[model samples]
Target: MWFFSIAGVGVIGVLIGGVCLMAQRKSLFGVLLSMEVFTLGVYVVIFSMVWFLSGLNSICLVFLAFGVCEAALGLSVLVSLVRSTGSDYVGSLVLGHF
Candidate 1:
């Protein structure tokens, strides 16, 4: 559990730094991919919490389910956005389309 938490934090930090330097995630697809990586870190932390607390594994499972759903939703939105705008620009998602 502790290992997972530490690994999650470390990887997330690296990811953030890489993302900041790359500046290549100017599209919705790249944004969603980053979000999924972030979600994975969250899942690891949550799993560690549940493990130490002696709680039910259901909590971890539920979070995993949500992550899956988020990935699916992101992909669908990306596809639709591309179809409508002919591009997967991140700006479109933030321009009050919601």
Candidate 2:
């Protein structure tokens, strides 16, 4: 009942993120945001399952910490890329620039 509804929302989130990632008109930051959304979807599914199966635990905290670190690292890369290229368009990026 409620579980199915919640899971459906999580799945929808994942699908939306996937669509965003596949979009052609996206900037580098947009791609990173999409990836973050995908990660968030995964977190939602895992957190819901764990919470339902037992009680909330330290594992949830670890997952959150990882998500934060991933976002930070990704943004750092994006910043460097923008600084070097003066643009955030993925298509314009060249391997030699790095």
Candidate 3:
């Protein structure tokens, strides 16, 4: 029951994040934020599953490492984008692309 609830929330989070990503693809910050949310949902789902199953100890650690790497990469991309554009607006950045 708890597993299903957590998984459901994660699925919803992913859907919302996907929509945000598709709508704001031009903005680096928006993309990064959306990705973060999506990843967090994934982590939540996985964590719940692991907790319910009483799985391997290393699984959670591995997920944590992945999350850290993702955050670092996302932040780096956002910084580069901001440096180049001087604005965080997705629409403006996308308009400049062409």
Candidate 4:
């Protein structure tokens, strides 16, 4: 059951990433957001697996730290994009060197 749940989450994350990639076409913000979502899903799945297999311990702290860093970097990029473009709409910016 746990294995199935993890598999389902992984599949969903992959689908979301693929769709986002297709729609946005190498968009940095889109790719970042998709990656964040994928990362969160993977983290949850991994944590659950860890807990189920070995019970919780200090090792989980590593996952927590990674998630925090990923979120922080994502947010920083978002803020930079907003500040530079004055908007969050990806369509407004053209592809290529910014």
Candidate 5:
């Protein structure tokens, strides 16, 4: 069924995102990228739901807008962190450094 196939794709996205999030913890950029992947996975899942329901399709756009906003905010934070410490490494942001 097309439904199952689409859902499977979404699940794969989620799995890859999770793996990337876990494996790419070295830098803030990596983490942010992984989070984007994870968000995209969720968006795929939501879009699949929209595919089945015609009336609720607008929700997908709302999610996309929010995702963009989140990404922009995340990039700003990463820039700030890197500017303050001169490095994007997670270890550079240890608690004692504050």
Candidate 6:
């Protein structure tokens, strides 16, 4: 049924996000990627719920706008940090570096 399909997608998203987050130990890029995966999962779940409740509307649009902005800002910051430090390793970002 449709309900099962939705739940399956939600579960898959959560699993993907969890796996990506676990990979974050390798590099800052991994961390960002994982966060994006997690965000995707959140979006999927929210949109699904909204779709079931009231069809589509401005709420989905607003959530999408904010999600895009968040991802952009996060990636920009990551790029800046990498450029300044010459490395994407998580530990490279120490308080004293700033």
- What is the TM-score of candidate 1? 0.69
Cα lDDT, model 4, residue 28: 66
Candidate number with the higher lDDT (2 or 3): 2
| TM-score winner between candidates 3 and 6 | 6
User: In candidate 6, how many clashes are counted?
Assistant: 0
* lDDT measured at residue 22 in model 6 versus the true structure, 0 to 100: 83
1-98, model 3: which lDDT tens digit per residue? Answer: 77899888988888888888788756677788888888878878788888889887688789889989988987876677677777766566665562
lDDT of 5 by residue, 1-98 (tens): 78778877888999999999999867989989998998998899889878966568789999999999999999998998888889899886878663
For candidate 6, the lDDT comes to 0.79
Candidate 1 ranges beyond 4 A from true positions: 1-25, 91-98
lDDT of each: 0.74, 0.85, 0.80, 0.72, 0.88, 0.79
Inter-residue clash pairs, candidate 1: none
Residue ranges of candidate 6 with Cα displaced over 4 Å: none
Pairs that collide in candidate 3 are none
Deviation of model 5 at 15, angstroms:
1.2
Residue-level lDDT of model 2, residues 1-98, one tens digit each, is: 67777777778889999999898474989989998898888788777888778876788889989999999999999999889989888878878976
- List the candidates ranked by lDDT, beginning with the highest: 5, 2, 3, 6, 1, 4
Whichever of 2 and 5 has more lDDT, that candidate is: 5
lDDT of 6 by residue, 67-90 (tens): 899889988888888898988887
Winner by TM-score: 5
Over the stretch 1-98, how does candidate 1's per-residue lDDT look in tens digits?
A: 56665766847755774574366556877777667767776776677677677789898888899989999998999889888787887665656654
Clashes of each: 0, 0, 0, 0, 0, 0
Q: Give the CA lDDT, 0 to 100, for residue 65 in model 3.
A: 95
